[model samples]
Target: MSSLVQIKDVTKTFHRGSEDVPVLSGLNLTVAKGEFLALMGPSGSGKSTLLNLIGGLDRPTKGSVSIGDDRVDQLSERALAAWRARHVGFVFQFYNLMPVLTALRNVELPLLLTHLNKAQRREHAETALKVVGLSHRLKHYPRTLSGGEQQRVGIARAIVTDPTILLCDEPTGDLDRKSGDEILTLLQTLNQEQGKTIIMVTHDPHASARATRTVHLDKGQLSTAQPE
Candidate 1:
């Protein structure tokens, strides 16, 4: 498979008063198409930072992040947003769904940025909800759904755009063991059946075990960049 995501000597730093604290330094890693990668670390380990960089939500203070042939770190804000819209899907610990919108409408939100018509966008959203087995709950609000259902809606929203790279931050952090397992299995199916390149951050070893590869990050540095 092709190399879908690449991190070359990537480093991130933040300024606290007069001193610059570094979280990542000279990190190099590559994730291939259809690969499921788990990022593990304790608090302040830079796992979430790495996921943000991959998703183009933040730039590395130094170094480069390349998605396919494009150097994401180098893109301008506007360009990066456009690139992300086309290539990246994001799932977070929180559902981040609009409280007023029904599940179907919430999933349809991402598609609004596209040029697709309302009908076309609805079709896409419905298909995505169906994929997560939520078609029957289309009219339900976030408060009406279970934790798993909400997360599934989040997943459906993320992939409704048909992105090549799916970046999930603490994907199962808010769910019970059974719910988390179900979410993990669903992600596994996405990688195996749909060939979406997934990079996920989690503290759970069992969750990490479900991935094709696991990367450990410590103090923002990739302690283990290669697959395990």
Candidate 2:
């Protein structure tokens, strides 16, 4: 498969007071289309930072971040926002669903940024929820759901936009073993059956095992990719 995401000699730094704190330095990596890749490392290893760059959430201090044909690091702020809405979906460790919104409504949030009508958004949201096996909980609130169920809702919301890639940050970190396994299974199904390219940051070996390939990061540099 062709390379879908490329990071070339990328570096990220933050200015803390008068000090320049570097997070990533000369990092180079590539992810192919339809790949389910896992990034693992100890805390503060720049895994999440790399994910953010790939998703166009942040730019590198030096070098390039390319997703397909777009040079993400070079996009204007407004352009990057639009690009992300169309091409990237994010899942966080903590479910970011709205407390007051119904499950279906929360899944429809991404569509609101598009030109889809209310009915169209609702249809797409329902389809996404159904895919995640949460159709029965369409009217439920986030607070009413279990940790696993809420994460399912988060997965549904992430994919509702049909983005080109999924960027997951510790997606199952908050759930129990059974629930985490279920979520991992769902992700595997999505990768194998739906051909969705996934780049996930995980601390759990079990969670990383679900991916097709795994790579390690240490202090901003990546280790070689290993078959899962």
Candidate 3:
């Protein structure tokens, strides 16, 4: 597997009034194509920061972030937005579905940015929902679904566009143990069967255990010993 995502000597800092708070310090990492990577860390350890940088949701204060041949840190805001829509798919802890949209409609949101027409988008969304085993719930709203179902909907939405990589942040954080386990199984299937490169930030040991590789972060740096 070749490298698909690369981070080099990256640093991220935020300013709170007069204080400079650093999140990631001179970090370096690489993710291979079709690899499922779990990032684990305590609060304030820069796990989410690193994920955001890789997903192009945030930029590094210094150094480079490269996905494929594109230098992410160098893209203009407009270019980055366009790039993210095509190359990245995001699944948040909260299953960020719109209350008013049905499962199919929610999954079709990303397709609207592309040239696909309404009928084409609906077809694509239906296929994605079916892949997540939610074909029966296509007409249902988020409020009507269980936590696991909602997260499944979220996963469908994330994969509807067939992104280059999937970035998940605490995907099972808000679900119960059984629900979390189901979601983890779904993620594992997505990686193993569907060949999606995944970078996930998770605090649960069980969740991290499902990944191909688990790396720990503390005080803005990666631990030398990664668990496989």
Candidate 4:
């Protein structure tokens, strides 16, 4: 498969008061098209930072990041936002759904930015919720759903835009074992069946085991590992 993501000698640093704290240094990696990759590391290993950079939520202080044909690291804030909205989908540990909106409306939020009419948006949102197996809960509010259902709603919203890649940060972190397994299974299905390139940050070895490959980050440096 062709490369979907490429990172070359990337580096990122943050300011902590007067100190310059480096998070990632000389990071280099590539994700093949439709690949499922799990990023593993202890706390402060820069796993989240790397995900942010790949998702175009933040820029690297040095080096380059390319997703498909676009130079991700080079885009300005406004341009990156637009690029991300079109190409990248993000899932977090917590389901960040709007409380006031039903699950269907929450999933439709991304489509609102597009020129699609209300019916089209509703159709797309329905399909996405079905993908995540939340079709029956479309009218339910976030507060009324279980942890897994809420996360599924989040996944639905992420996929509703039909992004080129899906970026997940501890996607199963907030769930019980059963729920986590379900989420992992859904993510794996997206990678294997839907052809969505998936990159996820995970600390659970079992969760990492579900990935096609695992990459380890330690103290701002990265090393590749085969998922066992």
Candidate 5:
């Protein structure tokens, strides 16, 4: 397993008024190609912050973030946006779907940034939906779908572009136990069968158990040992 994502000596700080809030300090991580990794911690533990750094949603205040051969932390804003559009896929806890769009159209949102024609985009979105067992819900709007269905749509949207990495933040946080398990199974299938590299931030141990490896964050630092 070759290294696909690397974070070296990274630190993140937020300035609020006159106070400096340090989130992550001297954090280092390496994610292998096609690895399913879970990040777990209590609130304010910087788990999501680390995921953001890896996904190019945010840059570290210090150190380098590298995915494959690209140094993400060094890229300009425009370049980083382009890079993220091409390589990173994000699935949020809230399932950020446009209310007016159907499931198919929502999944096609990411491809609009590419040169793919309408037909090509539709084909890709359809395939992604099929992968997540949502082919029948393509015409349904977010409001009409169940929590699990909405999350399946979100996953479809994330993988529609065949992104190099998938970043999920509490992907099943809003669902019932059964629904969450279903979503976790979908993620495992994507990892084991489709070979998608996933980095997920989860507070639930059940969610983390589905991952191939788990890392915990506390006070801006990572620990391999799970908390009791």
Candidate 6:
């Protein structure tokens, strides 16, 4: 498969009260189309930072981040926001669903930025919810749902726009083992059957096992060996 996401000699730094904190140092990575990649590391190893760089939520201090034909590291904030809405879907550890909105409305939130009208948005949201096996919960609010169901709603919201890439940050962290496995299976189906490329950051070995490939991060660099 051809490369869909590429990171070349990327470095990221943050400033804290006259002090510079280096997160990633000359890191390089390539994710192929339809690939399911798991990023594993200890806390503060820059896994989430790397994901942010790829998703255009944050820019690298040096080097490049390329997704498809776009140079993500170079895009302006406005352009990046538009690009993200068009190509990237994000799944967070927390469901991040609004407590007041029904599952369908929460899923429709992202489409509000597009040209799609209310009916079109509803159609897209319904389809996405069905994809995540939540068609029956469309009218349910987040507070009324179980942990796993809420996460499914979150997944529905993420994929409503049919994003080119899914950037998941510990998607299963908040779920029970059974629920996590279910979510992982759903992700696998999306990757294998629908060909959605996914880059997930996970700490659980079980979660990493669900991915097609796993890479480790330490300090600020990448490695193949599992951390001890």
Model 5 over residues 45-116: C-alpha lDDT tens digits?
A: 999999988988899999999999999998999999999999998998999999999999999999999999
Residue 38, candidate 1: alpha-carbon lDDT: 93
- Each model's RMSD to truth, in Å? 1.9, 1.7, 1.5, 1.5, 0.6, 0.7
Better of 4 and 5 by TM-score: 5
Off by over 4 Å in 4: 225-228
Per-prediction TM-score, please?
Answer: 0.96, 0.98, 0.98, 0.97, 0.99, 0.99
- Writing each residue's lDDT as its tens digit, candidate 3 over 144-209 gives 999999999999999999999999999999999999999999999999999999999999989999
Q: Which should have the higher TM-score, number 1 or number 3?
A: 3
User: lDDT per prediction?
Assistant: 0.91, 0.94, 0.95, 0.94, 0.96, 0.96
TM-score for predicted model 4 compared with the true structure: 0.97
The candidate with the higher lDDT, 4 or 5, is 5
Q: Which digits, one per residue and each the tens of the lDDT, describe model 4 over residues 26-138?
A: 99999999999999999999999999999998899999999999999998889998898899889999989999999999999999888999999999999999999998999
Q: How close is candidate 3 to the true structure, as a TM-score?
A: 0.98
RMSD of 1: 1.9
lDDT of 5 at 92: 88
Cα lDDT of model 2 by residue, 120-211, tens digit:
99999999999999989999999999999999999999999999999999999999999999999999999999999999999998999899
